[model samples]
Target: MNGPGGYFGGCLTALDDCLRGTFGYTAPATLLWRDASTAREHLSRALTAEGRPYDLFAGTLQVLAEGGMHVTLA
Candidate 1:
């Protein structure tokens, strides 16, 4: 995790930047997401800027995968 006000980004573009080592960590990383199911349930109800329904959990997983990161949901 980032330290001292470090931000991992709130949107996909920022997440991509962080995954690229722009924020410090690089890709091909492993993420162990505890209570991911609960988080997913909440995040999946999010909406986009256009007021369209979006599956943030799935989207995040896709982005992480695209960045070569292995995600383990617990």
Candidate 2:
């Protein structure tokens, strides 16, 4: 989606904005995510500000789905 060395921020909000065409790509797109299992495993252990367990992988998928992106986990 982005050019080489292009950055669109690291937070979910930024990801949502990028999916909305804020950076360039349009919504309702398709994404082939390779090695998603590893990402999921790591993100699943993430924590929130209040030290609560946060499923970042699920949250990220939610954001992507909300942005109209169909993700295929490989």
Candidate 3:
């Protein structure tokens, strides 16, 4: 997996490579990404508003896929 190679390749493979190298996944993880640029503008300015300088996510999702459990949200 991770294919032992280049960029943005084999998502599941990367996870497999991670599990193999680490010997196992000690904790559950969620793997996701966005190429979106400036997309956050539509949301409340409060996210960056405080100058608190941190990221906040306000909801949740429960997903069962590929015999694995995943929870996804902002």
lDDT (CA) for every model shown? 0.82, 0.82, 0.34
- lDDT tens readout by residue for model 2, 1-74: 24442665588888778777667667667878889999998999899989999999999999989989899999
Question: Which is better, 2 or 3, measured by lDDT?
Answer: 2
TM-score of each: 0.82, 0.83, 0.23
* Residue 28 displacement (Å), model 3: 2.3
Ranking of all predicted structures according to lDDT, beginning with the best and ending with the worst: 2, 1, 3
Reference-based TM-score, model 1: 0.82
Name the better of 2 and 3 by TM-score.
Answer: 2
What residue pairs are clashing in model 1? none
The residue-by-residue lDDT of candidate 1 on 1-71, one tens digit each, is: 33343777768888877777666676667888889989898999999999999999999999889988899
Error of 2 at 69 (Å): 0.8
Taking all chains together, the TM-score of candidate 2 against the true structure is 0.83
Q: Which rank order by TM-score, best down to worst?
A: 2, 1, 3
